[model samples]
Target: MKIAVTSKAFAKNETLKSELQSFFPDCRFNTSGRLLNESELIEFLGDCDGAIVAMEQIQAPVLDDVNLLKVIAKFGVGLNNIDLSYCQKNGIPVKWTAGINRQSVAEMALGFMLMLIRNLYTTSNQLKKGEWNKSGGQSLYGKTIGIIGMGHIGQELTHLLKPFACRVLANDVVDINEFCEKNGVVSVGKETIYAEADIISLHTPLNTSTVQFIDATAFHKMTKKPIFINTARGELVNLQDLHDALLNGQLYGAAIDVYDVEPPTHKELISMPNLVCTPHIGGNSAEATLAMGRSAISHLVDSLLGAANER
Candidate 1:
């Protein structure tokens, strides 16, 4: 059986690559150090029976074209890039494990909150330019933190914030009353979160309902002019609206790890002094990378090996 690994991070791990090759002798790794485009991905997966993929869009056309593909083991939690409905219809099972990188993402979110509230990011940039600026900022303690999407990452972040003694307002489409009660998180609406939070962090996935979720209308509802942090999907926040919010002081500042485009093309938005940007490394910690890779490999091995026995 042939297996293809589309994640560069997964491919680079010698232990994982060796383990996979031992299991499936015909295993292939992507040597290109960049995210694969749609055509490149389809071509790479052409002769493989199974694949481990990350951040690549797998649509109906790709699925229709690739007949040998039987299973896709997702390297991370998010599934917005895959065409799930099409895969289901065609009997192409997608194996995934959730919360594998929850702690890693939560830690990054916590770091962003601390940096933004303490004005550390701006001060450090100023110091590099030979300017001595002593700007006192607010503490994370006693602040109202609004967390949208109380899933694995959100819940993990709430647990991490316990020492800060901040009030956590959580919102999710599904009911998580038990979890909220246990964690002392206030279950609230989106409007309430926007109006009351001193810092707003997003952890929602990208779907039809949540694409461009934070827009001009949402920004206008910010009564507290909160500092925004998005470690979630990039399309969740509108780039133009975020720029306007910073310009008009609708938000104190923002820490963005994800964007509408990876390696975002918006130079003005990224170059703003008030915004702190990262190249989507929120879940790429060494520990998290190993955990996620192992999980994906487990799913691939289980599904394919089990199916082979059945046949």
Candidate 2:
């Protein structure tokens, strides 16, 4: 059987490359170090039996052309990139594991919180320019933290924050009262969280109801001028609104690791000193990268090789 890996990052990992070859010698890997466009991606998987994908759009058009493709496996947690409806209608099995990178992402959010609170990012940049600004900002200890989604990464963040003794307020669409009670988290409405939190972080999934979840209206509701952090999907927050908030002082500061556009081109927003930006590496830690790659490989191995053995 042939296999194709669409994730450029995953394809570049030598460890993953070696491990995958041991199972299936005939494999295709994306080595361009750039995301393939629709036509390039379709041609790449033209003859593959199974595929490992990340961040590539696997919708009807791509699936329709890849007639030989058997199964689809996810390399990361997010499913918004893949077309589940199309896969389901055609009976294409998609194997995925959630929360594999939970610790890595949660740790990044914690780091962003610390950096934003202490003004580490801003002051460091100033020192680089010989300004020597000594504005040490607030501390993360005993501060109110609002987490928008209390899922795997959110729950893991709560565990990590126990040492800080932060007042954690969480709001989710599902019932989290029991978990909140056990962990000393307060289950509150989104309005209450926006009004009171000293630090606000988003960890929700990207869906219809959650797209543009935070906008100008939500920023205006933040009475505390909170430091904002987004390690989740970038579309969850409006890019223009976020820039305006940081510029108008509606938000104290922001640490953004994800953007609506990868390699985001908004120079005005990216050049802001108060805003710290990172190339979407929330789940790209050395440990997390290997784990996610291995998980995707496992799904493909099971769905194809294991099924072959059973037959």
> For every model shown, what is its TM-score relative to the native structure?
0.98, 0.99
**Where's the lowest-lDDT run of ten residues in candidate 2?**
32-41
Tell me how candidate 1 scores on lDDT.
0.92
Tens-digit per-residue lDDT, 35-129, candidate 1: 88878887999999999999988898787788899899998889999999999988999999889999999999999998989989999999999
| Candidate 2 structure quality by residue, lDDT tens digits, 1-311 | 99999898888899998999899999999988887888988899999999999888888888889899889999989999889999998989998999999999999999999888998998988888898878889878999999999999999999999999999999999999999999999999999999999999999999999999899999999999999999999999998999999999999999898888888977898888889899999999999999999999999999999999999
Which regions of candidate 1 deviate over 4 angstroms? none
Best by the lDDT measure: 2
* Predictions in order: lDDT: 0.92, 0.93
State the TM-score for model 2: 0.99
| Superposed Cα deviation of residue 110, candidate 2 (Å) | 0.5
